[model samples]
Target: MTRDFDDDAPRRLQDAGGLINARRRDEAERIRARQRDDDERIYVVTTNLVIDAQEQLARRRRLDRIWRAGAALSWLSLLAAVIGTGIAWGTTGDLARFVVGYLICGGLFLMSLLTLVGVYFAGRNVSSLQRLEAHLASQQKALWQLKVKSNPDVDERGKLYREEVTTAIEYYQADSRKYRTIHNRHRRPRRLCGRCGQLKRIARNARDGQPDLCDGCYQGPDAICSICSRIRSCASRDEQGQPVCVTCYQRHRTGEPCARCGRTKAVNTRWPIGPVCVTCYTAVLRSPAECPRCGMVQPLIARDDDGAEVCGPCVGFAADYTCKQCGRAGNPHSRGRCAHCVLAERVNALLAGPDGTITPQLEPLAAALADAPSPFPAIQWLKESPNTKLLARLASEGHELSHELLDELPPNRNQRYIRRLLVHTGVLEERNEDLDRIPSWLEHELADKPTAHASLARPFLHWFLLRRARQRAAMRRHPACADRDLRRRVSVALDFLAWTDQRGLALADLAQEHIDDWIAGATSQRRYMIRYFLKWTTSRRLTRELTVPSIPSQEPQDLLDDDDRWRLLQRCLTDDALPPDVRAGGAITLLFGTSTERLCHLTPEHLKFDDEHAHLVLGRHPVLLPPRLAELLRQLAEQPQLRPQLSRAHPGPQWLFPGMVPGKPISTHGMTQKINRTASRSAPRATGRCPPSLLISPARSSPT
Candidate 1:
C-alpha cells in the first residue's frame, strides 16, 4: 500500500504541473486577445485619419486645379479682349461705332482684370489648404508609427505616444503659421475714408499727412490767382502787388511803357539802341530821303548810276528817255530814237515807199498798225525779219490769203505773229472744214463702193475720226507722235471698214470669223494692230461679242552679250564728244533697262540728293546714282536753253529731252531716231568676229 502511494504522488505532482501550465496559457491567450483588440482599434483610427488626410489633399488638389483654370481663363479673356479692341479700332469707321466698340472692349478688359485678381487670391487659399493637408499627412504617419511601437512599459509607451502627439501638434502649428503667411502675403490693408466713408486702400502723403478722404472725394487747397482768378500752382505775387500766374506776370512785365513812344502797348519790336514800338519802327523804315537830282523829299528812294540817292520820279526820269511821238518814257536808243520809234522806223521801211508813204503791197499791214492800240510788238516783227519779206512777197503776188495757206508756210515765231496780224486785219480768214470732209484716200475708196456701203460705214468712220480727234486734242502738245499714231489707227480702221463693206457684212452682225479672216488676210506683222479697232468697236456695241487672238510675244533679238555691254559702257564713259543727252540716255538704259518712253518722261523732281549720295526714283525704289551720271544730270539741269519751246497755251519747265512743242516730253520716235544715229556712230569694232546683234539692230528695236 506504501509503495503504491509514492508512485501516485509523483503522478499527481506531474498532473498539477500540467494544470498550472494550462492556466498560464489561458491567461496569455486572454492578454493576446486584448492586445489584438487595441492594435485593431489603433489601425482603424490610423486608417480613418489617413483617409481623411487623403481626401483633404485631394480636395486641395482640386482647388488648385480650379485656381489654375481660373487663371488660364482670365488670361485668355484678356488676350481675347485685347484682340477685339484692336479689331474694333481698325475696322470701326464711324464715331458712334468706335465708341460702342471701345466701351464693349473696355468692359471685357476690366472684368478680366478683376477675375485675375480673384484667381490670385484663390490660388493663395489653395496653397494654404495644401499645407494643411501636409500637416494632416504628418499626423497620420506619426499615428501609424505609434500604433506599430512595441514598448511594454506604460510610461515608455505613454512617452512615445506623447512625442507623436507633440510632433503632430508642432506640425499643425507650423501648417497654421504657413497658412497665415500665405494669407498675409496676398492681403492689402484697407481704411475707411473719413470724408467719403468708403473703404479704400491707404495712400499716405509724404508732404502732409495721410488724406482722410479718397482721391475722388478729396478737395484740398485753392491756389487761385488774384489777377487772373485761375487755379494754378505757379501763382505768385507780381511787382504790381497782385497775385498772378506766370502768364499774367509776364504780360504785366512786358506791358511797361516803351522807351521811345511812351505807350503802354506791349513792345514787339526791339532795337539794339532801345525798345521801339511797331508804329515807330515802321516810321523809321519809311523815313523821307532827299533826292539828289530834284532836291525833293520822297518816301521811296533809288540809287542812281553815280551812287547818288534819288526820289522815285527823279530816278525814273533819269533812267528813261521820253519818246517824242508817244510821250512815253522808254529805254534810250541810237540817234535819240526810243524803242518804239526804232521799231516803227523798221516797220515803215518794210511797208513804205522811199518817200515814207504806205505802199499798196503793205496797205493792209499799214492800216492794221494804224488801228492798233500798241503796235510795238507788230513793229518789232519787221526788224531784219524773214517773215516780213515772205509776207511782202505773198502780197505782191496777189495770192488769196487764208490761214490754211499761211499754215503751209514754214513755222517761225515771226511768221506766227505776221499771220495773227493778217487775220486781225481781215486779209486772211480762218479755215473750218466740214465734218463730212473725210481724207482724200478714204473719200476716193468709198466712192467706188455702193452708196449703201458708204452710208453704212459713215457712222464708223465718224466714230474713228472723232476718237482720233479727241486723242489729238488731249495730246496736242505731242502733235508729231500723236498724229502718227492717229494716222496708223485711222488707216487700219478705214481698211477694215472697207473690207467689211465689200463683203456686205453689217457691223452689228460681225462675228469672230470675219475678224479672223481679216487678220489672216492682213500682214503678219500688223495682224495684231486690228485688236485696238476691234476693242473700240466692241466697246461701242457696234459688233457682236468677239475675242481677238492675243499677239504672240517675240523673243528679244538684241540682248547685249557681256563683251557688247562692256564695249557700250566704255563708249558711254570714254567718249567726251558724244552729246550729253545721248550719253545720259544710254547709261540709264544700260544700267536700269529703262525704255525710252519712260526716260523721256523723267524730270529733275525724280532725282533726289542727300549729303551722302544722289538717288534716282527709277521704279518703286530709289536707285543710287553713279557719280558720272549725277554730274551729267547736274550739267543738264543748268542748261535751260536746251529745253524745247513750249506752247503759249501750256507753258512749263523744259524736260530733259524737250519735244518740238512746249510743255511736252521728247517724242518717242524722235528719241528712237536720235538713238539710232548715235548707235550707228558708236558701233563696236571687232577683231575678225561678227558684230553683236545688239550693236547691229536699230535703236528702236534694240532691248533696253
Candidate 2:
C-alpha cells in the first residue's frame, strides 16, 4: 500500500522521534536534572522542549482571555436577568400566554443565576492565578539558579524547596492560622545577619547538612563604623533599631543614660571617662576649658587621678579635637569646622541671596540662630524643620522680612511660627499675634463667600469687631477670647446672609419676624451671636431696628453649700499634697470668684507684698489674701525653677501661672481644665458674686 504524504507528515514523523527534538529535550532535562520539584512545566514538558517558553506565554494570555470571558458572562447574566424580569412583569395578554411568558422568564432567570455563580468562581480562580504568576515571576529566576546549583540533592529536595517557597509567598500574601505553624517553623532557624546584627533566615546546606547565610546578607561584606568603632554593616542601628546610614547615626541612635550628664539619651560616643550623651558631648567638645591638671586650654573630657579636670590629649585619647578653620581645640562637626561655625555656615547658606551673601534684613535672624546657646538643635532644626524651607525661600527671593509680607502668605501654622521666630529674633517688630491674625483669618474665611455676604461681613469683622479687639490689645491684654468671639460672629453673619439668600430675601429687607425666626431656630450661643450681629447692623443703620430677644442668663443651681465651701477653703489652706498652682488658683476661685481667664493672666506684678499681708490685684481694687494663701502665692512667685527654661531666657513679665510656651501665661482653658480636675466643686457657682461665707473669719467659720 502506497501512503499519501501530506504537509503535516514530516511534523508527525518528528513528533514520533526526531534528532533535533531529542537534542532540545536533552538540554531542557539537563537544565532541570537536579530540579526534582513537582513543577507543572517540568512535568508537562517531557518530550516537547521547544514549547516551554511559548507555552508559558500562552498560559498568561489564556488567563487574560479567561478573565475577560468571566466578566462578559457576568454582564450577559445580568442583562438576561433584567430582560427576563421585565418580560415576566410587563407582558399583558391572555392567561395562557402570560403563563407561558412567566415560564420562559423563570427558565432564563434560573439559567442566568447559575451562570453568574459559575462566573464568580471563575473570577476568583483568575485572580488567584494572577497572584501565583506574580509570585513566580519575582522568584523564578533566582529559585531556578538555586535549585540547579543545589549539590548532591535529596530525593525530594526540589519538591520540598518549591513547597517552602510557595508557602513563604502565600504566608506573606495573607496571614492564616493554618499556615502560621509552618511559617514559624520555617522561620525558626534564624541567625544574626552577618552584615547587621538583625536576625534573618538560615537556609540549610544540602551537602553539609548545616545552616548557611541567607541570600541577602551573603551578598555584602561588613565594614568598620567609624563613630562606634565597631565592625558592622555601613548601616548603623538607629532609633527603634532601624538601620540608618552612618552619617545620621548620632542623630538617630536609641539613647542610653550618659555617665557624665546622668540623663537617659542618645550618646555621641564612649569617651575615656564614660558614656556621654549628644548634648553633653557636644557642649564639652565645643566649649574649650583650661584643664586644671594639664593647664592647657582644651575640651575638658575626663577627671585626673587627683580628681582634677583634664583634656582628651592629657588623658591620652587619640581623636583629633582641633577645628581646622579657627585652630580651636574642639571636636568639629563637618569639614573640620566646629559646630558653631557649621551652624553659622548653614544659617548663612539658608538666608543667602542670589549674590551669595546674607541680606541686611535677614542678618539679625541669621545672627540669632547661629548664636544659639546650643548649636546642635539649631543645626537639626535648619536641616529638618519645614519652617526652614519657608524662611529659605523668603530669604533667597530677597523678600523683605516684614510682618506684612508674612501676613500675605497663607495664615498657616508654619507661617505663624516663622513670624514668631522673626519677631523673637528682632528681625521683625513685635505685634499682638492674636489681634493681628484675625484679619488674615477673615480674608481666608471670606475668600469663597458670595460677594453680597462678603460686603456684609467685611465691615462687621474689620470696623466693629477688630476695632474693639485692637483697643483690648492696646491695653496689654490678650484678646484670645475676643478673637474667638469675632470669628464666631463673622461665621454666623455669613450663615444668616446665606439663609436669607436661599429664601430670596436681602439683609436690608430682613424684618423683625425673620430675625425672630432665625433666633428661635438657633442654638443658645448662636442666638447670642446672631443678636450681636443684629446689634452691629442696627448700629450701622444697614438694617431697620430689629429686636432679637436676648438669651436670658440662667442663675446657678449648683452652688456649694456653706459647710462644703469652708471645707474646700480649708483644704486649699492645708492640703500640701495638692499641686501648688491648682491650690492657689482654686482658692482664688472659691474666695473672690476669679475666673480662670483672670487667674492665667495674673503676673508677679499683680501680687502686692506688704509688711503683714499679700493682696492679689484682680481688678481695680487689691483683695487681701489670708496668711496661708499669701504664703502659697509667695512660694510660687519667688521660685526660679517654677518658670520654664525658655521663659527665663527672654525678658518678659513672669506669669504667676506659667505655661509651656515661652513668654506666654498658661491658657485660660488649660487653667480651667486643671482646676476642674482637682477642685471643680470648690468653684463659686454664682455668675458674678462670691460666696457669702467669705465675710466670716476662717477660725470662726471652721466646722465644729
Candidate 3:
C-alpha cells in the first residue's frame, strides 16, 4: 500500500499540471465559440420570409401601376380638354355655362378613346410580366427554401420556409415523373473535363465538318500517333498517302520500322471499316474503293441498274416472276418480262390478237402513244382534251406517240377521243407527209405571239425585272457570300442583263460601264465570259457610252483599224455558236449582214445546182454562192464528226446547227462564245497548230 501510493502520487502530480492546462484551454475555446456565434447571428429563415413578402408586394405594385395608367390618363385628359374647349367657346361669344356643358361631353368622349388605347397596351404588358414572374418565382423556389433551412431566423419564418420547402419538393417530384420522357428524348451527353469543365467533341470535328475539339482546343493535329506513340509530325504520308495522327503516328516514323512493310518508312494504320485516316474519309465516300455489295475492291455490277455486284442475269432472279405468254422471267418491276416483249405484246394483242390474249385492253392509250416520241407529250394531250381535239393538237404540236407513251398516259376520262386522234396523227406524222412536225406556222406563232398576250406580259415583266434585280443584289450580298461577295454581285448583274435581253428587252438602253464594272469585279472565267457576252452581244447598241476593251486578240493576222468596227463585228458574229434555224440565223444575219432582214429561211434543198455549181435560193431569188464559202458548207455537210449532228439518234430533222434541247434553239449570243474559245488553247490535249476551220463574219464593220 505504501509503494502503490508513492507511484500514484508522482503520476498524479505530473498529470495534474497537464490536465489543468488542457481543461483551461478547452473552456476558453467553448466561450470563444459561443461569443462568435452570438456576434454573427444569421437569420436565414427570416431572410427568405422577408424576400417572399418583398417580391409579392413588388409584383402587386407593378400591377396596380399598370392599371392606374389608363384611369389616370383618361381623367387628366378629360379635365384638360374640358377646360380648353370651354375657354375657346366662351371666346366665340357662346353662353359660358352651356359651352362648358357641351365641352364636357366632347371631352368625355375623347377621354374614352384615349383610355381604351392606353388600357390595351398596358394590359398586355401586365399580363406578360405576370406570366414571367410566376415562372421565375417557381424556378427560384428551391433556392429560397434552401437558404431558409441553412440559417434559422425570426418572425413567421417557420411557416414561410415550411410552405416554400414543400412547393420546391413538389416541383422536383413533378419533374421526376418525366424520367421516362427524358430517357426517350435522350440527347448525347457531352464529356466534360474533370479539371476545368471543358467539353470534348467527336474525332475530326474541327475542319471538314468533323472536329475532334472546339477551335481553341484544337492543336492542328496530333504530333505523335495515339496508337504507336511515335513522333511523325514532319513525316510524309505512307505509300497510300495517309497522315497518321500523333498518338498513332509515333510507331510509323521513317526511323522506326513500319509494321506492315517492316522497312524504316512512315507507317499508316489500315482499317477494315474505312479509310486509313480521318483526312481521307470524304474522298472515300464519293467513290469508295471497296464495293458495298461484295466488300471487295471494284466488283462487277452488270446486273443492277444501280451497279450491284452481281451480274445482270442473277440480279432480281429471286424477285422475277414468269411471264404467262413468253414463259420467261425478267425484270420484276416490268412485271416478269422485258420492256421490248411488253411493248410488242401490247401492240400485237390490241391490233390483231392470238386467241384469248388479253384483248387489246388499252386501245385508246396504244393509239395515242404510236405518234408521240416520248410519254410526256402524249400525257399532256390527255390532260388537255378528251379525244379528237387532243389528237389534232398533239399532231399540230409535232408530238409523237410511243408504246411507252400509252403505258404512261394519265387517266382522265374526259379526253378519250383526244387520245385516239393523238395516236393516229402521230403515226401519220412519222410517215412525214402530214406537215405536222412543229409546223412552219407554229414557228411563226412562237415568234409572233398574239398581240394582247404580248402587251399584257410586257409591263408586268418590266416591273418584275426591276424588283428581281434588287432582290438578286441582296441575295448576292448575304452572309453566304462572305468569301466571294464582289464576284457574286458581278455575276448577278450580268445574268440579269442577259435575261432581260432574252425576254426581248432592248439592250440599247443599258450602258457598257454597267457591264464592265460587273466583269471587273468577277473572279472566275465563267463570270468573265458571261459579263463579256451581256455587254458586247446583248446590250452593245444600248450602251454606246460604255467602252469594253477588246479581249486580247487571239487572231494572228487580221486587225481592224476602227475600235467600234471591231465591236460591231463581234456583235454581228456571236462568239458562241448559234443554232442553224430561222430565229437564230436571223438574229446573227441582222447584226452581221447588210440586208438579212428581208431574206427568209432557205433550206439545204433551196441550194440548187446550175450546170456545174450550186447557188442558194434566197427569199425568192437565187444568190450566187461564193466558192470558198461553198467549200465551208461542203465541209459542214460531209464530215460526220465535225458537222455536229445536234442529236445523233434523230439527225437531219430541224434547221442546220440545231440546239441540243427541244423547244428552244441556240441563242445568237452563244454563237459568239463558241468562236472565241481557242478550242483546246488552254487545255493540255489541244494540238498546238491550227484547229478546226469554219466561216465567221468578216472582222470589219461600218466606220464609226
Candidate 4:
C-alpha cells in the first residue's frame, strides 16, 4: 500500500505542480496587465505634460511676434509722422496752418516714441516667457527620461518603477508651482498716476520692490520748480527739500562769478563785465585805474608818454628832468626846472625880501635854510612870518631846534606847525615829552651816582621809562592814553625809588619790608603804580624776590545809573540845541562805556559806515553803531569846525574834538573841563556830580 501511495504521490505532485504553474501563469498575466496599464497611464500623463509645454512655447512665440509687430508699427508710425510733418511744412501756404500741422505731427512723433519704448519692454517680457517655455521643455525631456527609465520588465515587482514615476510626477508638480510663483511675482498691479490720474502698470523698485509713477507723469515737462516756478521736464527733489528744475538748481549751485579778476567769489555789485568781487568793486568805487606800464592797480595820478594810466611811483620814476641845484629826479616844472630847483629859486627870492635887504636874523635863517636837506622847510618858512621869527629866536638864543623849546612856546597854530616841521625834518631831540618831567633828584641819582646801588637803579629806571614810553606810544596809536595818568605813574615810580634809596637798599637788595613800608603810607593810586614797577623789576631779575602787598579791592562806582543813562541817551537823541560834539561825545561815552579822554581822540577816520551797518573803531575790535548814533556820528564828522569855540587855534581836520593846542586831540584835563561845562548846560539837574567827569573816573579807577 506504501509503494502504491508513493507512485500516486508522484502523480499527485505532478498534478499539484501543474495547478501551481497555472496559478503562477494567471498571476503573471495579471501583473503584466497591471504593468501595461501603468505604462499607458504614464504615457498619457507625459503626453499631456508635453502638450502643455508645447502650448506654453507657442504662446511665448506668439508674444514675441506681437512684440515685434508692435515695434514695427511704432517705427512705421514714427516714419509716417516725420513724412507728414515734412509734407505739411513744404506744402502749407499759411503760417498758422503750418504751425497747427507741425504741432500735430510733433505729438504723433512723441506718441510713437513712447510706443517704441513700451514695445521694447514687451520684448523683454517675451524673452522671460521664452525662458519659462524652455524650462518647461527641459522638464518635459526629464519626464520622458523618467518614463523610459521606469521599466516594468526589469523591475517586475514595480517598486523602483513606481518610485521613479512618483519622483518625476513630484518634480513636474514642483516645476508648476515654481512657474506660478514667478508669474505672480512678475505680474505688477495697475496704479493710478498721482498727477494725471491715469490707470497704468507701475514698475517696481528693484531695491525695495515698491511701485513707482508712470513714465508719462514722471517725465512730463509740466512739472514746476519749487524755487523759480518754471516748467521743466528735468525736475527732481534735491537734498530732501523741494523739487527744483535743472536750470534753477544750477543757478543756485553756481552763483554768478565775479566779473573783474575772473574770481568765483561772492558778487558785490553788477558791472559791464557781469558781476564784481567786493575787492574789485571797492577799488572801482574808489576811482582807481590800472597802470598800463607796471600793471599795478592804484589811483590814477599821472599819465605816461602814451597817455595810459600811470601810478604815482611809476610817474615819479618817469620824470624827464633832474633838479639843477639839488640833482633830485622829478618831473619838469615850467621853464625846464624840477620841483626842488623851483622851490630853491622861490626860497632865494623870499630870503631877499621885497627890498632885497638881508637882516641879521634873516642871514642866519637863510644860511640854515640853504643848508637844509630839502627845500620844503625853507619854502614853508618863507610862507609864514611866524616860522621865520621862531627860527630867528632859536638861532639868537644859540639853542638847537628841539621839541622842548617848541613845547615851551605858546600852544599856537604857528608853533604847532613849526614843531611838526622840526619833527619831520628830524632836527628835534627824540625823547618822551612826559619823561622830561621826571624828578630832578632821581635824574641826578641816575646820572651822577656811581655806587653799586646807583648802577643797578639807573638801568632799572631806564628800562621802566622805555617800557612806559612804548606803552604810551601804543595808547597814542589808539589815541586813548591819558597824559596825566602817565605822569602820575612816573611820579609814583620816582617816589618809590627815592624812598628805597633813602632806606639804603639797592634794587637787587629790595626786601618785602621796603615794599610794605612804601605801601603803608601810599594812596591807592600810588600803591597801584608802585606795584606795577616792582612787578616789572622782578620780571627782569633786577630785584630780589619780594612779596607785594595786595591792594584792597573796591567796587567801582557806576558812572551813570539806569535812569541817568536813559536821560542822557534821550538828550543825545532829541536835543538839537546841544552842540553836535557834546551830543556825539555823550552818546559814545554812554553807549561804549568810553571815557572823555577816548571820546576826545576820536577822529572821522574812526567811524566807518557801509550800506548795512556802521562801526566805530574804539579799541582793537570795532563797536557796531546804532542807527541814531551813526547819524549823530555822521553829523559830527561832517562838521569840519568841531573845535571848542573858546580856542582860536586851528585843530586841523584830523581831530574830532580839537584841543586848545593845534594838531593835538583835546587834553584829558581839557576834555574833563569841557565835559563839566557841557554837563551843566545839557543836564542842569546833575550839577555837583558832573556826570561827564564821573565817566572818566570809573574808567580810570577800573583795573586794567
Candidate 5:
C-alpha cells in the first residue's frame, strides 16, 4: 500500500524526508480569534446548556433569603395581632371577643401555612436543578467522544477517537471517583491455604488467578513417598510452590513432650526452641508403662514414695479424695489409686495380654533360622557406622521389606559395600538374621527388590554368586578390561535374572548411560545371562527406551514347534520385497528368540554339525538342537539368492548365523522380528496352541 496523501492529511505524513517548507499558518487563526477571545472561549461554547442552572442557583439562594424574610414578617404580623387583641379585650371583653380571637389566632396560623408552602417549592426546585446537571453531563460526554483532537487538517482520527470514547465510557459511566487510591480500588484480604495451611493473599500471587492453598500444600512439592505412600517428597520444588515433604516435615516438627517425663517438652518445633530431642522421643516410644490414674499408656517413669509411678500433676495431690480401694483417708496408695490412697485400686488395669512382657522379634519371614553362616556378618561395623543420618536414612527405607529379601542382604552401616563384599556374600548365604542387624538396615535393605522364594535363597546363592565369587574377584584383578559399562551391565543382567520387577528402585538411578552401554556390549556368549541382568535393572521407563525389539508381541515361543522357525527362513529369503535386515533377522531368531538383543555377538564358529548331531555352541557349550533348526541353517549357509555372494570371506567372526557385516553379525532386533512374523503367520490354525510371543489367555482350569 503505497498512498499519496489527501491534502488535508497532515497527521498521516510519517516522514519529513529532509524537505523544507516555510509557512506561517498559525498567525491567521490567532489573528481571527484575538478580537473576540472572551466570546469564543471554551466556557462560552457550553454556556447555554448550564446558564439556566447558574440562574436557578442564584434564584434559589434569593428564595432562601425570602423565606427567612417572610418568616420574620409573619412573626411580626402575629405580634401586632396579639397586641390589638389585648387592647380591645381590656376595653370590652364580651363585645370584641370574636374579633380578638380571629385576629390573634388566625394571623399565627396563616404565617405557618405560608412558610410550609415556600419550603416545599424550594425542595422541588433543588431536585429539578440536579436532574438538569446530570443531563448536561451526559451530553458533554457524548460531544467529547465525537470531537476530533487538536488538528484541523487531519481527517482520520482513530487514535484520538478511540481514546476519547474510552474516556467517556470510563469517566461518565463509572461510579468510582478519579482520585481513588490503589488499596481502596482493588485490595482483598489474605486467606489461608486449605491444603497446606499457609496464609497467602486471596487475589495476589495466584497461578492463573486460581486461589492459593496453604504453605503445607501449595508451598511444597505435592509428591507421595514411593515407600510409605505418604506424601513424603514432591517431584517439584518447594520454592516453586510445589509439595516438598510438607506433611512429613510438619509431623516431624510438631513434637509433643516426652511421654515418660511429661514436664519436658518432647519434640522438635519450627522454632529452634522447645521439646525433647529425637533420642528422648525414641525412648518415649519404646518405654511403655501405664499411668493407672489416667489409664494412659505413657512412657515409664521412676516409682515415688507411694509405690505409684504418678505423672507430674498427680504427684502433688493434696485434696481429700477418697481412697479408691479402701474408702479411707490416706491409705498407702500404689499405682491406680486416688489421693486418699489405697494401693491396688485398679483404676487402670494393665492393658497387656494374658502372657504379658516385652518380646523383641525379627519382623519378616525367613526360609530357615537354623543355619549359621561360615562368617559372622558385619554386625558391629553397622551399629557403629551411622547413628542418625545414614542409619536413619537407610532404616526409614529398609523396614518395609519382606523377610526373604531383608535377610538376604545386611543393612549394616559404616561398611562401604565394596570393602566387605565377602561379608555381604556370607550374610546372603544365611538370610535368617534380618532383625539381628540394626533396625536401620530394614529401611534401606527392603526397598526396590524382586520377590524370591525363601526356600530357594540358600541354594540360589550357593549356585549363583558364592560359588563364582572367587572367579569374579579374579576377573576384577585382571588388566585390559575395556568395557566397564558393559561389565556394569553384566551386573544388571544378573540382577534381572535374580529379580522379577523394577518396583522399588528409583527410576533416576537407572539412567541412559547404563542402557547405551548394555546395548553396545558384545562380551557375553550366553545371551540369557546378560538378558536376565538387563531385565532386573531395567525400570519401566528405561524398558520403553530400550528397543531390542523382542518378539514384537509379549508371547512366549512354543518350544514344541520347531518347524515354524524353518518356514520363516523360507519366507524371508524367497520374498524379494523383504529387506536384507528383515530376512537376516528372520533366519537368526529361530535359534534363540530372547537373544534378539545380542545377535551381533553371534559368529560362524557357533555352528557345529555332523550327520549324527548339530549344535549352536551357546553359553560356552554345544546347545544341540532339533533336526528342523539344523536343516534351516544348512540351507541358509548355501543360499545367497537375494544378496551378493561372499568372496571366500569365512564368516567365522564366531557368529552362528552371520549377516552382511564381516566381523559383526546381525542384531537381536532382527532376530525378534523374524520370530514374531513366523509365529503370527503359523499361529492362526493351531486352535489352543499359540506362539510364546503372542499373548495367551490364562485358562481358569489351571494353565501349566
Candidate 6:
C-alpha cells in the first residue's frame, strides 16, 4: 500500500504543474483579446455610423421623389388653367365672367411657380447627399482616426491624421457642436449656398469684396483672368483693373526688375540696392557670399566704412535668417533647417529602404540629388514628380535596380528620364539609347505582323541592320540620325517581305525583275533603303543575286550666290549677338563646306592656337581662322559648360558645342537649326569648287 501511494502522489504533482501553465496561457489570451477589441472599437463604430447615415440618406431621397411628383402635378394644373382661360375668353360673352376666369388662372400660375421652387430645393438636397455619401465612403480611415483622437478618455492626444484630413476634421468638429447642444438639435445654418441654394456654414473671401459663400458654393469669384485669358476664380485685380488667377496675381502684381538676378518679376521685398523678387530675396538671404571687407562668408547686408561688402553683424545689425541645425546663416525651410539640410533629409527619406537604411546601389543617386546647387527645385521635384514615387517604391520593395528591370516597366518618358538620371549619376552603366530602344520598337511593330512576314524580317534585322548598328554604337556615340536610319531600313525590309507575300512569291524563287517592280513603286528615299535587304539575301543564298541601281547624285538647284555667301560669312564673323556655337559652326560650314554632322564631332582639340592665328582641323588638313572667328573659337573652348548644373559631373569628351544631355555633343539637327535661325535662309548644297571670293581670303583657304 505504501508503494502505490508514492507513485500516485508523483503523478498528481505532475498534473498540477500542467494545470498552472494552461491557466496562465488562458489568462494571457483573454488579455490579448481585450486589447484587440480596444484597438478595433473606433473602426467598428465608424462603420456603424456610416451605415446608419446611408440608410437616412435613402429615406431622404424617397422624400425628394415625392416632392418631384408633386411638382409634376403642379405643372399639369397650370396647363389646365391656361386652357380654361382660353375657353373663358372665347365662350363667355359677358365681360365680368371672363375677367373672373382670368384672375383664377393667374392664381394657378402663382401656385405652379411656388411648386417649382420646392423642386429646386429637393434637387439641391440630392446633390448634397451624394457628395456627403462619396466623402464618407472614400474617407473611412479618416473617420476612424477622427473618432480616436476626439475620444474623451485620453488626457493628452497626438495628431492621428495627416495634414490632408485637417480641413475635413475642422468642419466635422464645428458640426459636432450642433449635436452637443442637446437643447437645439436642429441649428439653423449661417448662410445659404449661392449656387445650390442649400443652407450651410458660411466662409467669406479675404479680398476683392466677394459675396459670402458656403463651403460647397465657395470656389472663389470667377472672372476672366487677364494673364491666362481664361474665366476662373480670380484671386485679385491687377493695376489695369483686369481679374487675375492666384498664380498670375502673385507673379504679375507690382512687377519690377530684380536688382540681384536682373529678371523682371513681382517685387516681394525692397533692399537698399533695388526691388528684389521672391526668388532672389530668398536666395540672397540663404546663400552666404564672401564679404570683401572682412573676407568672411556671410550675408552681405551693408557696405563697410571703406565702401566694401560686409556682413550684417559687421555693420552692427544682427542676422535674422540663420539655420538652427547647422548654425549657418541662411533662410530656414522647415523646422529651422536650411534648404540644403531639408533637401538632404528628404532625399534620404526617399531613397531609404524598408529597414530605414539607404542601399549601396542608390547612394550615389541620392548624393547627387542632395548635393545639387539649388535645393528649392529639388524640393519641388520631390513633391510633384511621379519619378520620385517610382524610386520610393523601388527602394521600399528592395528590388534590384538594373536596366533590365527598368525595361520591364512600361516604356514611358518618365522611365527614360529616370534611367538617364541614374546613368548620369553612375547608378547605371551607360548604353546607347538609340541602340537599346530598337529591339522594343521592333517587337511592337512585329506584334501585328503575320508569322511568315515576321520570320522573314526578323533574321534580316538581327543579322544585317542591328548587327551593323551595334558595331557603329560600339565605335562612337550614336548620331541622332542613326535611330531614324535603322528604323527606315527595317520598315522598308518588312515592306519588301510583305509585298512578296501578297503576290504569293517566296524569297528563294524571287528574281531581279520582282525587285525592280517593287523599287519602282516605292518613294525616292525608300528605293535606296531596299538595297540593304537585297545585298544580305544574295549573300545568304536566300535569293538570286539582284542588282539595285544606285541613285545618281543630284546637282544643287538653289546654290547661294557669291553676295549671299559673303554676307552670311560676314554675319558669322561680326554678329556678337549670335550664340557662340552658331557663329563658329555657321562660319565653318560656309568656308570649308563642312556638313553639320561633321561639325558636331569638332572638339576644343580641333582648334590649334599659334603666335598669330588659330587653325581649325575640319578634315585631315587644318584651315586658318580669321582673328574674330579665332577669338570666338577660343571663347567657346574656354567657357566652362553650356549647362553648368546638369553637366557638372559629365565624363564624356568636351565638344566645341555641348547639348543639354550630359556626355553628348550637340546633335546635327540642333546645330543646323541654330545656323538657320541666324542665316534666315537655308543655304543649298555648294558646288565642289571653292568660290573666288573665299579663295582670296587667307582664313577660308586650307593650309598645305
| Best-fitting candidate, scored by TM-score | 6
Ranking by TM-score: 6, 2, 4, 1, 3, 5
Q: Model 2: per-residue lDDT, tens digit, 122-209?
A: 4553435555556455455545544455453676676766776885676465657546656665665676644445666654322355
Q: Which lDDT tens digits does candidate 3 get at residues 186-266?
A: 333344533334674322233575434533344345455444556545233556665566444454444434332345543
- The 0-to-1 C-alpha lDDT of every candidate, in the order given, reads 0.60, 0.70, 0.41, 0.60, 0.42, 0.71
The digit string of per-residue lDDT tens for model 4 on 244-355 reads 7867666776556775578787677554335767787655433545668777655444556776556656856432334455544433344555545665565455545434
The sequence of per-residue lDDT tens digits that candidate 6 reaches over residues 402-428 is 988787666665776677778888888
Models 1 onward score TM values of 0.35, 0.52, 0.21, 0.35, 0.18, 0.58
lDDT of 3 at 568: 36
- lDDT score, candidate 4, position 679: 61
- Rank all candidate structures by their lDDT, best first, as comma-separated numbers: 6, 2, 4, 1, 5, 3
Minimum summed lDDT over a 10-residue window in model 1 is located at 683-692
State the displacement of the C-alpha of residue 398, model 1, in Å, after optimal TM-score superposition.
17
Can you tell me which runs of candidate 2 are displaced by over 4 Å? 1-291, 294-300, 305-338, 471-481, 552-598, 602-704
The residue pairs in collision within model 1 are 646-662
Query: How much does candidate 1 score in TM-score?
Result: 0.35
| Model 6 residue 25 distance off true place after TM-score fit, in angstroms | 31
